[model samples]
Target: MLSDMTATTLDVPAELPFLQSLSWFDAHWRELTPYQMLQRYERGWRHRGVTADLSHEEAAFLRGLIQRFGSAIDVPA
Candidate 1:
């Protein structure tokens, strides 16, 4: 089973299409910085107590996003 931290971090990509389709990026793009999103993910991971098991595609997507946008979220050491 994946830990809560992992699940929360992985959820970002899954929500990307919906966020974009809703035009959230255009309206609140400034307010929704990558760092802020990472912070939210960290908090969510702490709250959920369970992590996600990412598929290969999901992993690749996240890596690409991180490389493109830059992430402030850090995996637990």
Candidate 2:
């Protein structure tokens, strides 16, 4: 029974088309500047606990965006 329960991961593609459709800052925290994205993410993390609404890839993308563009803005975690 245990042997039959092996976990399998799906290779889902990134939501590039969905992203492309959205305008800049589509949502309140959608695709604003990297610093703003980081700021909103960090604020959400602070108030609501962990990233319940975000997927692992989305969270990682936010971090990468900050590192790539908002490295100088030091928002405390």
Candidate 3:
């Protein structure tokens, strides 16, 4: 389980497009700073939780997204 360290109840839309929902997650946690929220997204998706239920293609794309850019996220601008 990706440690649900924060006691948050995100209102993510189950039927929303993958990218859109990700953007939403990003926007929602803006206070945490982009880097911080991105880390949370990566962590949240790492274990079997909400993101675990994503479709295979979606999950692959997410993994690809993380691999391509998330691996070395720069400080939030």
Candidate 4:
């Protein structure tokens, strides 16, 4: 009977855009080092005013990076 048949998985494309945006760490974020991530976060905040594109999880991740790396270090002028 069709109802009793086991379900088969569908062949889905891996690079779906909607799925990528929903993930916690997309490919670009995954490739960045902690310091580079922090710099990107700060730049976003500066450019976007109070409406930076970062989610709370991203902010928390940057907080962790700041704690680990120490914010006193200077960026090159």
Candidate 5:
């Protein structure tokens, strides 16, 4: 006999405080998954409507994460 399996793993931050604070997350409530939240946070999609008050380290972390994730996406020149 044989068995079939399917699984996926994502490298999400252990403590995503900023993501937890988003109203969209609160409003949409159950629709957003951990991976979707991580993707949105990395792409700066949450920053569009509001001004972010990030510290130097936070800004740098976001930039690094975006660079790592957004490498697959094309950017306009």
Candidate 6:
């Protein structure tokens, strides 16, 4: 059924290095709080030359991440 599957387009606000976005709690990721990481995430999304679309299972997983902490990501005035 591989040929019958349709690809879905996902808009990930930010793209992490080597798909590091999935490792939200890794020690390196822990270095920055969710708020801090979210800030950098927004910035990266803004200037990222590569497209931020993930049309696969990871896309669904990352969307969950955004939904989980998106409300808390804020930039200072």
**C-alpha lDDT of all candidate models, in order:** 0.43, 0.42, 0.43, 0.42, 0.44, 0.44
How well does candidate 3 match the true structure, expressed as C-alpha RMSD? 11.7
Regions of candidate 3 where Cα sits further than 4 Å from its true position: 1-40, 50-52, 72-77
Instruction: Give me the displacement of residue 32 in model 2, in angstroms.
Output: 1.3
Candidate 6 clashes between residue pairs 3 or more apart in a chain or in different chains: none
**Looking at candidate 4, what is the lDDT of residue 62?**
47
Clashing pairs in 4: none
Q: Return the clash pairs for model 1, or none.
A: 3-50, 3-51, 4-50, 4-51, 7-52
* Cα distance off (Å), candidate 1, residue 19: 12
Predicted structure 4: lDDT: 0.42
TM-score of each: 0.33, 0.39, 0.32, 0.41, 0.35, 0.34
* Alpha-carbon RMSD, each predicted model: 11.5, 14.2, 11.7, 16.2, 7.8, 12.7
Q: Write the per-residue lDDT of candidate 3 for residues 9-53, one digit (tens) a residue.
A: 443334424333445546554355333444655655434334334
- Local accuracy of candidate 4 as per-residue lDDT tens digits, 1-77: 33222222222233323222433455565444445555555544444324434444444554555565556423222
Instruction: List candidate 2 stretches off by more than 4 Å.
Output: 1-28, 48-51, 69-77
lDDT of 4 at 51: 40
4-67: candidate 5 lDDT, tens digit per residue: 1111133444444455444343666324554354465646544643644444443454554445
Clashes of each: 5, 0, 0, 0, 0, 0
Q: What is the lDDT of residue 45 in candidate 6?
A: 50
Error of 5 at 68 (Å): 0.5
* Cα deviation of 39, candidate 5, in Å: 1.9
Residue range 20-46, candidate 1, lDDT tens digits? 333333666334544444444444433
**Model 3, residue pairs in steric clash:** none
